[model samples]
Target: MLKMMTYFQGFSGHQSVPVTVDFPRSPPKLPSTSEAESETSMSEASSEDLVPPLEAGAALYREEEKAAKKKEKKKSKGLASVFSVFTKGKKKKGQPSSAEPEGAAGSRQGLDGPLPTVEELKAALERGRLEAARPLLALERELAAAAAGGASAEELVRRQSKVEALYELLRDQVLGVLRRPLEAAPERLRQALAVVAEQEREDRQAAAAAGPGTSALATTRPRRWLQLWRCGVAEAAEERMGGRPAEGAEVPESVFLHMGRTMKEDLEAVVERLKPLFPAEFGVVAAYAESYHQHFAAHVAATAQFELCERDTYMLLVWVQNLYPNDILNSPKLAGELQGVGLGSLLPPKQIRLLEATFLSNEAANVKELMTRALELEAQRWAQDMPPQRLDGHCHSELAIDIIQIISQAQVKAESITLDLGSQIRQVLLVELLAFLRSYQHDFNEFLERGKKLRSYRANVIANINNCLSFRTSMEQNWQVPQDTLSLLLGPLAELKSHGFSTLLQSLCEDLKPLFKRFSHTRWAVPMETLEKIIATVGVRLPEFSELQDCFREELVEAVHLHLVKEYIIQLSKRRLVLKTAEQQQQLAGHILANADAIQHFCTEHGSHATWLQPALPTLAEIIRLQDPSAIKIEVATYATSYPDFSKGHLSAILAIKGNLSNSDVKSIRSILDVSTGVQEPSRPLFSLIKVG
Candidate 1:
């Protein structure tokens, strides 16, 4: 069959091939068929004769299978190419299999042709076999290099720069793998550098924008570092020294220094630029300026130190003083410091005097001289027109002056000191007292005469009266009198006479009689009739006595003998005349009881003598003997007529007598002459008859 097929394949190539073929015996049975049918049969037989055609089909199938095998071989070769690229360390230059392959082909046909899982990519990166990642890495490197090289540079420069960039990126990645993780590192240094650079840039821009004169470079820059330093110092100082100091120690110096350096220029500029913004702070500055001079005086060679410490210290002081002026004033340490400096020595005499006066006024001696000195200093400071020093000087001077003025006006009267002095001194005091009283009255009257327009006139009058009374009381307590001189001096005053000086004198005597009695230890020796006669003689003529009758009747009478019934009829009549009302009579009775001796003496004087005594009877005889018959007769007649209820003529006759009498004598007479005609007659009938009607 092979030989035949071979020959047929050769013959076919040389000759024409049949269009149809059929089976002989089986096909002869179909001769009766029509020509079209025969043609159809021939067509069918041609379709059925497929042996050679099948062989042809088999050959085509084999060709298709061979073509598929060759395609698969090519695909395997492409896959091997990609796998080699991925697995190789570097591409071999001239090796066909190791040559650069198309990206899509490599990607599609490689062992890792499909999308890589995260683990695979990570493993690939970990292994440092980045041939698979080279293209991506190279692209990134190029971008970074371009960025680093800047757009203004050429391509070659960019490429050359890319090498360093790639190296740096790889180095970082390698280091990240080898060292501790980047998550552990701090980012602060980078951030800080960035901030610093940014600030520097801003500063430069600001400087460039500024005009020549306005430029911060020429002015502010020179002080910028200093300013920053000062600000830092100030903040630290404030933190340390913001509060009040401890008991004895002062504020820390750093605080003041910081404030001094930082705030001084700013403060001055603020004062110039915006004075109204900080009134209190400005005031503090002024106060500090003033206090600086005060504090400067204490330490030795203070001027040099002052120059050093002045500005800051002044600022601090001014701030404190303005806030608390009184507190500053009261600071004893500050005061002592000021005084030590002889600040007061610089003041004018007048100002010093004023200060001294004030100290004297307040009774503070220790500070008086200091005050005076301060005043002097103030004057000097003023004269110098040194405002910084003047305030303290003026304050001290004014304070001293005020103190002195107050003290000078507080003097007490000399009479208040009378008790400390002797009677001789008292007598002088009394004279002074009298003079003062008189002057006071004169002044008061003058004040009134001056139109009574003065507000203090009445007050002066009252004060004078009080002073006079006080003087009198003082004199009475201190005055020493001889026993013999007592009666002689007081006799006339004891008499209750008329409304004149005698009355006043008599009141004084009466008031003083008991004091005398206590000293004498005896009854008064002077006859009551004599006292009466004296009072009657002196009363009308004494100015006080007359004035007393008009202005002070009751006090005037009380001032004289408190009891007048024991004396002569004139005394009784005067007492009755002065004390005419029922109330006055009752008060007089009470007074008599209070002063029994005086009352007895007065009664006995009036009861023993008649009111109408003989004109020839010497006043001395009547006073001594209590024998004024006419005075007695008049008293007896009046008593009988006045007391009709008492029918005892003897008692009535005794009562009528105008000389001092005792209460016992009157009682005895009343008992003996009770209603009986025999006892009704006077005991001294002869004397009574001598003045009978």
Candidate 2:
């Protein structure tokens, strides 16, 4: 009964089961001995009659199971058919189905080719086929994963070989684009950058996706293309430097100029062209700037270490200090281009210091050399008996202009680099300039002493004096000339000026000496012919004064006026001729008055601003002419008031000329002249210059 119930339960549930069953061959003819036994048999037979046939039940269960399976199969087939139509409709024209063989599909896909050689990859990259190249890169990564996942030795090598080939090709392509960004197509550059970005993305994904000890993470390369790109830019910069100057060529400014120009041109392209193509995080402009600056700095460092000439050193300093920062990196064209880029020095601080030191040392030597050469050239001109060329009727030489330019140019260049450097250079130049000034002084003195009779003597003297003045002016303006340094420099200049002025004045003095010798108390009463001759002599030289510089001319005129007055006083004092009679004193006074008038007229007409000296002779004439004792005392007081430089010696000489005065009268007039007054001395003292003895 348990077995029958289990069989019936298995058939009655949703589960499919065969209905065939083996029944007992017949109902057991059990004990009919009692009426109860007969009734139990009839009841069992009635249960048997009520049960279904096993064949029919088994067939009905089979039919239902088959129907459900068939219904499910038909529904799945319909769904599959609808999905196929949708997928096929969305497929690209002529694209192979996934069911196609690998070889057949690959050929149609254009992915079938010999593994790309380096040259082939380059060609494709040139064509901007970065998208096409991605599968190959992916394959290399897959190979790397396979090798990392315990591949056989042979299989590993084979996979690695292909992987290495791909890597080399990719590296070359990336570096090439960076090295020649301007030459690469804009789209190609963008694509290359995209590929690099994609590689970074893949690396990140792989690192994140794999466990710490997983094969995928172990197989992933770092994708250091960004770093390689910087190196490539550095190479580009080095290439742009055009190599060290040729063996015999002067390391000219053009070397640095070319470097700066190319850097700017390429960098501008990166900012305007490549920057837009790349993402902001790539920092395209800054990367190029930093790379160029670093490589340029290294190159400069190497160049500075060499034994360069003065010009080469100067050119290098100009580029590194001025043009690189002021004109190239921070130029208007790239004004906003490198905003966030930290472009470090073109040379390291220590390196720049060394370079600056070299520059100052070299510049000092150069200044000395050039200045000496300038003096030598001037000396040569002097030796040739050539007068300095006159510009606008004034003597001029190249000495001052040349020296000033040399010093100024050095200062400007150094200062542009750094003020401290400029200050240092100024000190160096000052020392050299001082030495040159000394040499100039010696040379000029020799010329004045030896070249006195030469026709060019006056002109050359004036030219040198002008040179000294120019040197002083330029040094004061351009350099931080200290007081002592200025004194040292000015000492030579002042002496040169004095020597020149004396030399010039001596000529006029020579002409006037004979005229002055004629003056005496006896001759003073004669016709004023001597005075006329003196005036004429001075008149002849007045036009020649126009050849001097304006300031020097005025000073020379004042000097000439002062000297004439002093000579007049000296000549007058030397003659102790007494004016005993009123007529003799009056006549002498008239002659003295006429001479004063002539001298004053001549000096004033010729740019002499010495109005102070004008009163000296006239007042002295007034003192000499007055005969009344009391009136003569008044005139002496007037003379003392106007010519405060008049001393006791001068007074005694004048008193001696008044022969009519009694000894008491002379003592009284002398008493009236007081020397104790603390009067200010004249700026240009004529009487002090005159020796009564």
Q: What Cα-based lDDT does every candidate model obtain?
A: 0.31, 0.65
**48 in model 1: Cα distance from truth in Å?**
99
Residue-by-residue lDDT tens digits, candidate 2, 441-497:
898889888887788888888887777668778767755667887788789888888
Which residue pairs clash in candidate 2?
A: none
Provide the TM-score for each candidate, comma-separated. Answer: 0.19, 0.66
- Runs in model 2 with CA error above 4 Å? 1-192, 202-225, 228-258, 380-427, 452-494, 504-508, 521-523, 527-529, 540-557, 575-591, 622-644, 658-682
Per-candidate clashes, comma-separated: 60, 0
> Candidate 2: lDDT over CA atoms?
0.65
RMSD of 2: 28.2
**C-alpha lDDT (0 to 100) for residue 313 of candidate 2:** 70
Question: Could you tell me how far off, in angstroms, the CA of residue 222 lies in candidate 1 after the best superposition?
Answer: 12
Q: Global CA lDDT of candidate 1, please?
A: 0.31
